[model samples]
Target: MTDLRHRLDAFVKLGDFFKEYCKYAKNQTQIDDNQHAWLKKFDEILALAGHKNGWFTPENILFSLESWAELLTPSKLESWLMAYEVDKNKPKSVALIMAGNIPLVGFHDFLSTLITGNRAIVKLSSNDQVLLPFVAQYLIEMEPSFKDKISFADGKLEDFDAVIATGSDNTSRYFEHYFGKKPNIIRKNRNSAAVLSGNETKEELTALGEDIFRYYGLGCRSVSKLFVPKDFNFDALFKAVYPYNTIIEHHKYANNYDYNKAVYLMSLFKILENGFLMLKEDNNYASPIATVFYEFYDSMEDLKIRLSQEQDKIQCIVSKGFIADEIPFGQTQKPSLNDYADNIDTVDFLLKT
Candidate 1:
């Protein structure tokens, strides 16, 4: 078997560990003495991560882990990679500069680098510094061959042949300036949006709430804008999303909501809010935290064309049969391994490099 096969099995084993660990954390399962050590270590890691970054709530951290665990199964990994010509590539030092907006946000690039016979030199975001290294250590332990395949960058990134960097629009310019000479994929800021027709059922609208509120709307895949029909009544949306009302209890989220709401009020901008979430009419895609920007559309065809033209600014569209390749509501966070970010195939890019 190729070393890639061993890497695949190692990831599968790590997935199993994550699944079991989540079960144990939730008290759905118990661990014996042999497993207690690992459980304790992970417990410490999750706690420290939450402590370091207030946005990294324990629930959100576990959610991210469980989401990745579900995707790293044997069938899922093999099926996603089969499309790429991975075996023909020579090893290159791939520098991965990750963004910290969401937990494990840059993991796909790291995984792509290693799974395609490349070495990874990762520079983690300060906001999310701890989790990926723990994951890497597990992978290395699972298959000793991986020890040489992955390494973390400390101060300066050097001797890398290719790059995959994620940052805001401003930082992306710097990434391009520094790494333009190399084979690179430098991603800038992008946000997701929902196209809502007035005819949506309560269930679908409720599901849309997940697309809006998960990770408190920090993830690129989180829906931050809405394109609604003219004169759309938001009573249904407010009511359907009421279950997530407790989100305001988080101090950090509440602070953002309070601050943004105050600024809008002082500026005399018309707004509607449900105490926990606010909606403002605007054309921008990237809304501030605790708020969603929306615009009314008179024609679906025109709206589709507009979205197509602005595809670069969108990570994914959350809707129901609203457009081809529409992501079902509530599933934006549950992306398959094949759902490449920014519609760029990282695995293919690495293999070609």
Candidate 2:
């Protein structure tokens, strides 16, 4: 299991499993006898996942599967690791403290530690307890050697050489207090926002709705805020994103919408709404569910400077021609392998450890 090729092959096979399962689940393909049983297994798993967490909708879970399947190819994995010197590494136990804001939110860290020939001591969030354990089981089934390489922590985490922990700004302090002395990557709350010039096309605006509404705006990559020019009209934007009005049909989403709207109204906040989504003018980067906070900018130059100053508080700035690393309006959630969380190079850190 120390050899990189064996671990890499295991991940590729796992990716194939995900790709085939997705196709079969969608009625786009057929499964053979050996793999037929997995169909029901994954179906039940998705159902259980949704039951455990209301926000883990089947579509969002499937999207996560599809995205990982697309990225785990031989060429993509090789290309990503190609930039780093991965061979000369002493194996160490790495502790992974994951967040459950989105489904499979911590898979990258799990994947990184195991793929680099290190033992993983995982501590999964209660909100996402099932998915990754099943994933690890599948990988171990594909390559039995991985069984000894990964273990889940049910109580306090100990006997790990390093750690990668993700949480909110508050929980991050708790993490630092406990695991502060270890070689670690501790991530805090960071949000994404979009910059608009009021001239976006209909299709672009429609796509931006995906960025806003997907995962119920829970992921760090979800667009929770917007920077728009003064006097920006909302008529065109609302008309374009009207197709996603059905998002309000989900009971949990509808509850959030009703709750946040009532809170805003009672507080005498001036907000704009199109029945499903709300728009409020706020200076903050993080917005509550069902609402997107927007701020007016006087000039592009000044806005760029402001975003630069707050870059640490921002994750991905979804825009066109605004910043060097600006993610496209709708592609924030669909990040590639190189899009490290908090912009920290996990692979490089693990390789050295």
Query: With candidate 2 superimposed using the best TM-score fit, by how many Å does residue 170's alpha carbon deviate from the native?
Result: 0.7
Model 1 TM-score, all chains together: 0.99
**Mind giving the per-residue lDDT tens digits that candidate 1 earns over 6-44?**
989998988888898999999999796776888889999
lDDT of 2: 0.92
Model 2 RMSD to the real structure?
1.1
RMSD each, Å: 0.8, 1.1
Q: In model 2, where do residues sit more than 4 Å from their true spots?
A: none
Candidate 2 lDDT, tens digit per residue, 180-295? 99999999999999999888899988999999999989999999999998888888889989999999999999999999999999999999999999999999999999999999
Per-residue lDDT of 313 in model 1:
100
lDDT of 1 at 169: 95
Number of clashing pairs per prediction, in order: 0, 0
